[model samples]
Target: MFSLMYETPSSWVQDVEALGTLTLLSDHAHCELKAAATMQALVAKNPTCDSIVRTLPRFAMEELEHFEMVEALLRERGGKLAEQDTSPYADGLHKGSRANRKSLLLDRLILSHIIEARSAERFYLLSEHLQDRELAEFFGSLMPSESAHRIMFLRLAEGLFPAEDVQARTAELRQMEADLISNLPFEARIHSGPKQ
Candidate 1:
């Protein structure tokens, strides 16, 4: 029942091709590791937050599996993983986040929802249009995982605090997330800005 902060534009499918399929696969591989790292980090930061501590490791493992899948595809396509440029898309969202410990956790939890929700939408778009059936199938397969993760984060948020409070904060964060997406310069990455 979760929603994306941003709806990927119709142009993004065509735009993905501009980056070349290899680049897309490589970026996807890198993103999976980043997702895992975030989960591990949350686990570390909130040792006393047993809810996060118990859940994040399992999610991290799932992300690693996704990374492996994308890495395999990248290698198969003659693409080698290399240094990726800093993502303005991520940096911009992070810059607006609150700094206090409690707020950080809440914001991060909500941010996870935003990230997965957006990823789910983009993967669906890519899955629909990717010419190769195998690649399309692979991306298509990720939607369920993305959907689960997105929902899990929101559930955790509600579990941690009052439902109404979480909803209020989520509304604030969601608007910020959408604005962040709409304003950034477009790129071919899955979480990049809206198409120009």
Candidate 2:
């Protein structure tokens, strides 16, 4: 049900298994925090966009709540949040975005949609495959919220931009996202490829 061009390799489950639960939870907590920050940043950047202004603060709060939940999970597993490198998956998407002011907002929204969609996909996989029942249930519970966030971003983009423009850009960014996912080295990250 996601709009992703790529399917995460099955090997990712094994990679996560090797990475261990604490490391995965720590990385997941960071992703949730970053998601919250990204939503807030979108609001700040496009204050005049009524749809964005009306919708994103709530979304931001939801992301923050998700972050807190993940943080609690980490602590329960005896892991504390630690510094990790920014996701190359995300950074590559940003680099692929058009820098011109007219395209920037649309691109950013599309990127957010892609990120959320990919996240939901990974969460679904984990929910089904992880041997740890608690973590599996937690990830399963998050799938709907991530999917909703993905749809919301896309709708916001469509509301602000021409339908055709939104479609074309979303398609282009989806391809870019797919390529980035394929190339990134495997790690215990929400958006990562198979270990080389």
Which candidate ranks first by TM-score, i.e. highest?
Answer: 2
Q: What local distance difference test score does each model get?
A: 0.82, 0.87
Clashes of each: 0, 0
lDDT of 2: 0.87
The root-mean-square deviation over C-alpha atoms between each candidate and the true structure, in angstroms, is 1.9, 1.5
For candidate 2, write residues 12-58 as lDDT tens digits.
87679778878888888888888989989998998888899899999
For candidate 2, the clash count comes to: 0
Candidate with best lDDT: 2
Candidate 1 per-residue lDDT over residues 1-196, each given as its tens digit: 3475567675787777766878778778888899999999999998998889888899999999999989988898888886899977678778866632357788889888888888888788888877667887889999899889999999888888888878877887787878888887777677777666
Candidate 2 regions exceeding 4 Å error are 99-102
